[model samples]
Target: MGKSRVHWLRFLRLTSSFRRCPLSKRSLIIASVCVFHLLLVVSHFGYSQHQLERGIDEDKYRNARGFYNLDISDALSDSDLQTGASFVVPTRSNVVYITLKSKRLKPAHIRGTIRPKLRRKVRRKETNSAFTQYKLVTLERDAGQNKRNFASKTSLGETRDVYYKSLDITYISPTDTRIDSHISSIRIYSQRAPPWLSPKDVEVMRFLADANVLRIKEVSHGDSPTLLVFEGKTSVPKKNRKHTVCGGQCGVINIPVDTSEVFAFHLDRVLGLNRTLPAVSRKFSFLHDGQPCPVVSWDASLYPEGLAAGLSTVRLTWGEYQNSLKQRCWHKNISPKPDSGCFTVHHYEWSKLALFDFLLQIHNRLDHSCCGFRPRQEDVCVELGHHAQCGDPNHIQLTNIIHRDHNPRHLVFTNNKGFFDRNEDNLDFRLLEGIKELPEQAVSVLKSKRLREKLLQSLFLDQTYWESQGGRQGIDKLIDVIERRAMVLLTYINAHGIKVITMHV
Candidate 1:
C-alpha cells in the first residue's frame, strides 16, 4: 500500500510540473504517461500467465512420478543432459497399479463312516452294441514275476480254498468260418505287395524270416558276424551248397545294433545301386537275447579261400588306388597295362562306391583312417591310432576293398556299418577323391527329392524292422540324416562339375 501511495504522489507531482509547460509539450507528456501505464499492464499480465503455466507443468510431473517415484533429473546422467538428448516420459492417467496377494488354503480333513451302495440288477431286452468285447491275453510273460507268484501259491496250497472257474468257450459256427475266410480272401486280394522289391528279393526275405535255424557259426574275418545256417526248404533246390560252409540257406546275423545293414540294403535297391547284399531284420530266439538283428544274405563267394581266409580284398595302397582312378581301368573293355597300376574294378565302380559311401558316410572302405573327417576319440581310426598315420597318406593301405571271387570287376558292399550320426560338416570327402563321375539313376533319385519316400516304402516291407525301429517316426529321423547328406552331395557334385553318366555296367 505504501509503495502504491508513493507512486501516486510521484505521478501527481509529474502532472503538476507538466501542466506548467506549453500546451504542445503538455499534450506530448499526457500521451507518454498513457503509453507507460499500458506497458506496465501488459508486463504484469505476461508474468501472471507464465507463473500459471509453470504451476500446471509441476502438477503434471508430480502426478506422473507418484507411483514410480522416479526423478527424471536423476534418471538421466549429467552427460546425457549436457548432450541435449531428448527422451519421452509417460504421462498417461489411465495406467493402473495392482497388487496381488496369494495365500495357500489348507485342505480340510473330515472323518466319517461310509456305507456301500447296493446295485439292483435289472432285466431288459438285448440290444446290439457297436463295441466289440475282447478278452485280455498276455503276449509276453515276466519270468521272475511268474516264478515268485508260483512259489507263493505253492506255500499256501493247503490252507487256501481251491476255486475253479468254469471255462466259457463259444464255438464259431461253419457260417462264421466261411465269412471269415471270405473276408481274409478279400483282404489278401486288396493288399498289394511292395513295388520296390523284386521276386527274388521277396523270396530271400521270406526265407530269412521263416527258415529254421540249423546252427550259428561265427565268421573268422571282418566284424566276426554270426552266421545263421537254416535248413533249406524241400520245395527250393540248393545251388551254392558246396561253396558255403553252412551248405544251405544261410544268413549273416550282425549285432542287434547294426541296423544300418537293413537301411543300406533298402537304399541300395531304391537307388538301383544293387551293390549291397539283401538284408532283413530278424530276431533269433537263441541269439543276442532274441533281439532284432540285421541279417544279410550270406554270400560264400566273398570268401573263396574258406572261412579262415578273410574277405577277398584288393591289395592296393592309396597311391595305387589314385593311379588306377587316373588310368580309368577296364573302361570301354580296354585292358590296362601291368605297369599302369590298375585293379580289376572298373573306373565307374569307384563313382558308385563313392556316392553310396558318401550318402551313408561309410568310411570303412575308402577312408578307413578317417583322413577326410574329424575322427572322434571312440572312432575305430582314432582308437587304433590310424588317424595319426594320415600324414603318410600315399602309403596308407586301403581296408575292406572287397570283391567276389567270381565277379572281380564289381564290388560287393559288405560290413556296411554306415554312420547316420556323422554330421554334414564332418563328411569324409576323401571317399569321393579321384571320382570324376556318378551314376545317373542314383543322382536322379537324390535330385527328385523322393529318396525319403522310396526308403519308407522299401523299409516298411520288413515288419520286424519297422516295429524295432519305433515305426515311421524313428525311420524318418534316419532318412532325414541321409536326405541332408544327399543335399550336401548334390551340391558337391555341382560345385566339382562331376559328370553324371549311366552306370548300368
Candidate 2:
C-alpha cells in the first residue's frame, strides 16, 4: 500500500494537471497528439482521399461489354441504381400505380392516371415523318458545383431524376410515312421499382427498360430493319441521341445472369425471344514446357453478324499461340491419329493447334459456317452470304450448345482441362450472350439431345426458319462476342478467388 498507492496517486495527479493545463501549452500538446493519432488514422483508413468513394473507385468490378465501353467503368452504372423509376402493373382496377414524384403526377386527383410516354426520340428530317420528339439533354451541374466527374459523366448519385420527363421535347418524323403508319408495334414493359430505390435512379431505369421494350420486339431482319430498330421512337439509340449515347437508361440494365442456368431461357423466352444478341479465345497445347507435339490439325478463324444489323465486318484475334506439335497426353478417342493435336497443359490446357481451332469455333456461330452441315450453318448463309461449312472429323469440330433446339450447347470436346467456348451466331447461339460461364446446370439440362434437337428444329428450322436451307452470319459472331465477354468476366471471377479457365472460343 505504501509504494503502490504513492505511485498511483502521483500518476493521477500528473493526469489531472495535464488535463487542467493552461491554454497555449495544453493546445500544443493536444495538437501534437492529434497529429500523431491522425497520421495513424490516415495510414489505417485514409490511404486514398478518393479510393474510399463508393461510386468512383476505378479499382472496382465492372461488367465486360462487347462493344466500345460507352458505359461507366468498374462502377455501378446508372442502370444499376434505379430510383423513382415508374412502372405499370396491370391490375384489376387500374395498372398498379407507381408513384414516381407523386407530387407531379398527383395520386390524390380522382381521375389521375399515369401512362408510359414515348419518351425515346425518333429521327426527323425536315418535312420527314421519321423525326418525332427529338431533343438533346445536357446534364450541366448547377452553378459553382461543376467539376469534371460531375459534368463529364453525370455522377449516378447526382442523377436525381431522368431528364426525359422534365426536359422540353421537340417532335420529329420521317418525310414520307406518317408517324402512325411507321410505328408497327409498340411493346411497353413496366415493373414496380424497388421501394427503397431513389426516385431519380428509378426514372433512369424505367426509361431504359421501356426503351429496350421496343428492341425486344424487333425481328432480326436485314440492315434496314435493324436500322429501324435503332431509329424508331422506342429505340434507346433514338432516345439517347445527341445526349450521352446509351447514357441515362442504358448504363443501368445489364443484369448479371446467375451462373447456374447459363442457357436458362429460349430466345423467345428471354429478350422475350425478341431482343437480339444480348450484350454482347484460343489456345495452345501439345507441348511439354516448350516441348513438342505428334500431329497438328487446326481450323481457320470464325466471325459474327452480331453488330447493329447492318452489314458490319468483324475480325477476331488469338494473339500468339504455340507451334509445338509434340503430343504427350493425346486423346486417341478423338481420331485415328495417334498424336491428336490436342494436348493437356496444366494451365494452357489445349495445344496451340487445338487452342486455335477451339477459339475459332467459339468465335463463329451458326456452326462454323465454313463448309459444313452443322445446326447453325444455314443461319450463316442468311446473314453473311452463303458459306456451307461443316464441323469435320478432321477439320470443323461440332459444338453442343444448351439451347438444343437446333445446336448442341456442349463444346465439340469437353476436357477436364476446363475450356469454355460460347458465342452469338443465330437464335440458339444468341442466347449465350453476356454470360461469363455456362450455367452449372446447362450440362445437366442438355443431357438429352432429343429435347434440344426438337427445340432446335422447331425454333430455328420450323418456327423461325425453314424451307430455305440457310443460316444467318450471326452464329459465328455470337460465338465471338460470348468468348470475349466470358474472358473478361472470368478474369474478374478469378481475381475474386473463383476458379475458371481462359476457355477457348
Candidate 3:
C-alpha cells in the first residue's frame, strides 16, 4: 500500500508539471512524445518477461505450427505406393491391399481387426461440434519380427507382400464426428527389382521406363541397328519423394536380345572388371509420345541404308560391315604421344577388352560394318559411338575409349552384339598381345578351378532369366564356351607370362 501511494504521488506530480508547461502547442507535443516512448519501453519489458516465463520462442512456435499444418495425405496420393488407410463405415471391406512400405504409422484400431473381442480405453473429449478430440496412443515394436504385425524403422527393410482384407480392420472407437481418429499411411522406400537385370544401372533404367520418367534429350545421329542411346534425366515424381534409382542424367542403350551387351555386363560383373556400362534386357514398349506400342527391337535409323532393304536383320553380323577405316591406319590419325607409333598406355585396357572379346569369340572390334558407329572422328558422341574401330585393336581411336571423360586410359566395351561364335577354338589375342599386360585378378580368376565352378553355378542360376526370354540353348552354349575359353586363357597366360602394369597415364 505504501509503494502504491508513492507511485500515485509521482504520477500526480508529473501530470501537474505537464499541465503547467504544456498549454502551448510545442510543450504539449513534447510531453506526449515522452509519454509514448515510456509506454513502449514498459510494453517491451512486459512482453519479454511473459515470453520467458511461458518458454515461448516466437521463431520456434511459428516453425512448429507450420509443421503441424503440413498435409502428408496429399503427398501419399502422389507417391508410387498407394494409400490404404482411411475412415470408412463400420462394415468396411473384408480385404485391404496395402503397399509394403517403410515406417508406416498405423492406428490402434487396426489391431481390433485381428482381435475383434479386445477392448482398449480411449480418452475422448466432447467438443461443441459433432467431432470428438482424441490423442493417439501407440505401442511401438522393434524392427525385427514381432507377433503384433507392426514394424519399426529399419526392421522391415525388405519388400514383402502383405495380405489383408477390409474386414480385417476393427473399429476400435465408436463412429462419431467428435472422435479424432488416427490417420495411417504407408511410405514405400525400396521396391523389388526386376529378376533379369543387375541392381544398379539396369534396375534404374527399367524403373524410369515404367514410370514414364525418361525424356530422351536427343537421339544421337550415329546410333545404329535400331539401338537408341538415350541421354536423359529421370523425372522427379510429383509426389516429392526420393527414389532408389538414378534421377540425374545418365546413359541408357536400347539393344536387341541377341546382342552380347547384356552378357558382356554379366561377364564384367563376374570377372570384377567393371569396365563396361551396365545393361538390362528391355523390349520395345512405348513410342516417342510415351504411348504404348508393340514393335521389333531395331534402330529406326537403319531404314535409310541400302543394305537394310534386303538384309535379314537377324542374320546381319558385325563382321559383315566394312567402311573407310579399313583402307587407312588409325595409328597415323590418333597417336597418343606427339609422334610415337608404338601402342599407347591405353593398349593395356585394349588388352583386357581384346581378351574379353576373345573369350566370347567376338571379332567386331575392328569392323566398321559391325554394329559400330563410324562417326567423323571429331563428331563422336560418347554414348552412341562405336565399341571397336575398323583397323587394328593395337591402333585404337581415342574416341572409341569408353568412359573416356572419366578414365582416359581405360576401355569401355559396348555394343557387344557380335559374340559367342560357333568356333570355340579360334581365340584371337592380338589386342591382348599389344599391351602384354593382364590384370592379376583377371589371370587369377581365369586360373582358379574353384572360381570356374562357382561361375558355372551362378550362370545356371541366371539361366532362368535367359530361359524366360527363350534363350536357354544359347545360355547353355555360352556356359560351355566360357568354360572352354577359361582353359584356353589359362594356357595362353601361363605360356606367355602376363606382366601387370600400374600406371595412370
Q: For this target, which candidate reaches the highest TM-score against the unseen true structure?
A: 1
**Clashes per prediction?**
0, 91, 21
lDDT (10s digit) by residue, model 3, range 185-282: 11111232112223454333333222222332212122122222332344555354222222344344332333466566667666656666554443
- Residue 293 of model 2, lDDT score: 11
lDDT of each residue in 141-239, candidate 1, tens digit only: 232243344443333211111111111213222222432343210011102233345556766775665554544442233233223333333333357
Q: Estimate each model's TM-score.
A: 0.60, 0.23, 0.40
Better of 2 and 3 by TM-score: 3
Ranked candidates (TM-score, high to low):
1, 3, 2
Give the 10-residue window scoring lowest on summed lDDT in candidate 2.
294-303
**Candidate 1: residue 43 Cα off by (Å):** 87
Clashing pairs in 1: none
Q: How many backbone clashes does candidate 2 have?
A: 91
Q: Global lDDT of each model?
A: 0.68, 0.27, 0.39
Q: What is the lDDT of residue 163 in candidate 2?
A: 28
Could you give the C-alpha RMSD of every candidate to the true structure, in order shown? 25.6, 25.5, 25.4
For model 3, the stretches where C-alpha displacement exceeds 4 angstroms are: 1-218, 222-257, 286-338, 341-347, 366-399, 450-465, 468-474, 500-505
